[model samples]
Every structure is written in C-alpha cells, then in structure tokens.
Target: MHELSIATSIVDIAWEQARQQGGGRVTGVTLRIGRLSCVHEDALRSSFDLVTEGTPLAGASLAVIEVPVRIWCGPCNAEFELPGIQRFACPACGHLSGDIRAGRELDLESIQIAPDQIAADTPEAKQPEPS
Candidate 1:
C-alpha cells in the first residue's frame, strides 16, 4: 500500500535526523495532514508502524494533526472554508475561483525522542532479581 511507502519515508527522515543528532531514539512523530492532501491518516499510521518494525523508531507513536480546507473566493473577495470538495464555489456569490489558500499540505511537525528509557511497555517485574 502507499501508506507503507509513506511510513517508510517518515522513518527514513526520522532516522536521518537521529543520525545527524549523534544519538537519541525517536519516541513519537507529529504530522500535519491537510484534508485536501489526500493522505489517509489511518493507513499512514498503520504503515508507519509496519515500517518501523525492528528499527530505532519501533514503538514510536504517530500523531496526526488535521488541517481544514480553506479557499479564497474572488467573487466575494473573502476567504472561507470549503463546505465540501464539490462546493468550491463562493458561498456568498456562488462563483468559483482558483485561489486555493490552504488544505494541501503534508509536513512533519516535530519529533520527540527519549534517551535510553523511552516510553516502553514491559511485562511484570517477575518478583524482582532477588539480590
């Protein structure tokens, strides 16, 4: 799936950053996804998980931020959110314009990394090591 490829790209970028930084493991990744970007959030997340398997980014959380679709209406001389994909026309004047303001972005916002003890889940202590 394309999500697998997208996820692989994210990990590759994150790995590069980690390498440049000299250390530190990735704990989580934040993504800014636009509605018009056509990137499936669920699929992307799942792909990321699959690609991160056995890598430094393993167990990392993928957080997605939703961005709304905004367009500039030349007829109304105002910017507003598009009601839907089919309704790109201005709500007030009912005219269409090619001035698309936003809703076409796919960027990585930030990456959070923890030192050695990154957030990890483990089984019970098993009654301790017994000194």
Candidate 2:
C-alpha cells in the first residue's frame, strides 16, 4: 500500500526527466533500496507495475539495488556491513555503535530512455506532476 505511493512518486520523477529530455520513452528505472529502509522489494515491484499502467512509463522495467546496513565501529575504527539486520554491534571489537554510516536510502538512482521509440501508450495519459 505504501509502496504504491512510492511507485507513483518514482514515475512522476521519471516523467519530469523524460519531459526535460524532450519526452523520450522511458524503458527502465533503477532504485537503490536499503535494508533498513523498510520497503518490501516484491511489493514495490508490484506497485510499480500497477502505477505505470497506461502511462508513459508503462512496460518500464524496475531494477533494485539492495544495500545492506553498515555502521561505523568506533573502538575498531572501521566501518563494517552487517550480515543481517539482527544486531548493530561491531564484528571485530564487539563494540556497539550508534554512528550509522549508511543503509537508510530510498532513492530513484537512474532512468533509461529509448529515443528510437515513439511515446505512444494511452491517448489521454499525461504525465502527472509530483505533489
């Protein structure tokens, strides 16, 4: 349900980029999703498919780059990626760290456009602006 809104927002951004690029056909979208971001990949993919229906982004493939949670170890003085989201302790020194280095991202990384293809999907489909 929340993924649906996120998908809608992604499409909106893609549309704006497409329009800026002279309305090229969007073929694919890449998203960087973190483990701690609380976004289900399967649900997001399904929502993307639904939101893209009959729009300029219809048939666009969605690719997700899964990022693992990483934290900075102060005692060890290094950053390590956790094997899972179970604990936030340092692997080497066993020190607990509240300094998070990464793994809280939900960003639309890139968009692929096909210039050879004409923009023709649904007749009345206009790219909606992001609210």
Candidate 3:
C-alpha cells in the first residue's frame, strides 16, 4: 500500500525534526488529511506503527484531522462541503462546480515532543541557556 511510503515519509520528517531538537521521545504527531487525498486512515496508522518500531518515534501517537471536500459554487457564490464525492454539486443551488476550495491536503500539522511543542511550519524551539 502507498500508506507504507507515506508513513515512512512521516517518520522521516518527524525524526529529523525531533533529532534537531534533542532526540527526545515524540509523544504525538498531528496530520491534516483530506478526503480527496486518497489516503486510508487505518492503513496509515498501521503502517506508522510498523515503521516507527525501533526508531525514536517508536511510540508516537498519530492523529489525523479529516478534512471534507469543499467545493466553490460559482452560481451560489459560496463554498460548500460536498457530502459525497460522487458528484461535485452545490447543495444549496444544486449547481455543478469543479472549483475545489479545499480538501486535497496531506500535511503534517504539528509534532508534539516531550515537553516543548513544535508548532506548524515554525523553526526549532529555542534551547534554554546554561546557568
């Protein structure tokens, strides 16, 4: 499954980030996965566990934020969440729209390491000054 490769990449990224800090135990990882991303949650979770074995992120928890497909309805002049992917149609005006506003993301939101928090796309946390 492609999930394995995905998990591998996640591990690699988290590992590099963690290693940059202090190689501490990673507590959790947050990801934003969209419905249109075609990533199986169960498989990704399982693959994460398997890939993290014997690694620094061995016990890191994998959390996913499921994002629904949002389409921009031109006639309605608004964005609506598509209930189903069978067709991209506006719920209110019933107009077909191919303008996808969101829900095609597969991004690593944050990394929760030991005590310090590494916020999204931010640089490394500052280390404490020696006494």
Question: Per-residue lDDT tens digits of candidate 3, residues 5-101?
Answer: 9999998998788889876667688899999999999999999999999876776788889899999998878999998888998999989988998
Best by lDDT: 2
lDDT of 2 by residue, 14-44 (tens): 9999899987879889999999999999999
Better of 1 and 3 by lDDT: 3
TM-score of 3: 0.84
Off by over 4 Å in 3: 115-131
lDDT of 1: 0.78
Q: Could you give the candidate ranking by TM-score, starting with the highest?
A: 2, 3, 1
Where is the poorest 10-residue window by lDDT in model 1? 122-131
| TM-score, one value per model | 0.82, 0.87, 0.84
RMSD of 3: 8.6
Residue 43 lDDT in model 2? 99
Q: List the residue pairs that clash in candidate 1.
A: none
The better-scoring model by TM-score among 1 and 2 is 2
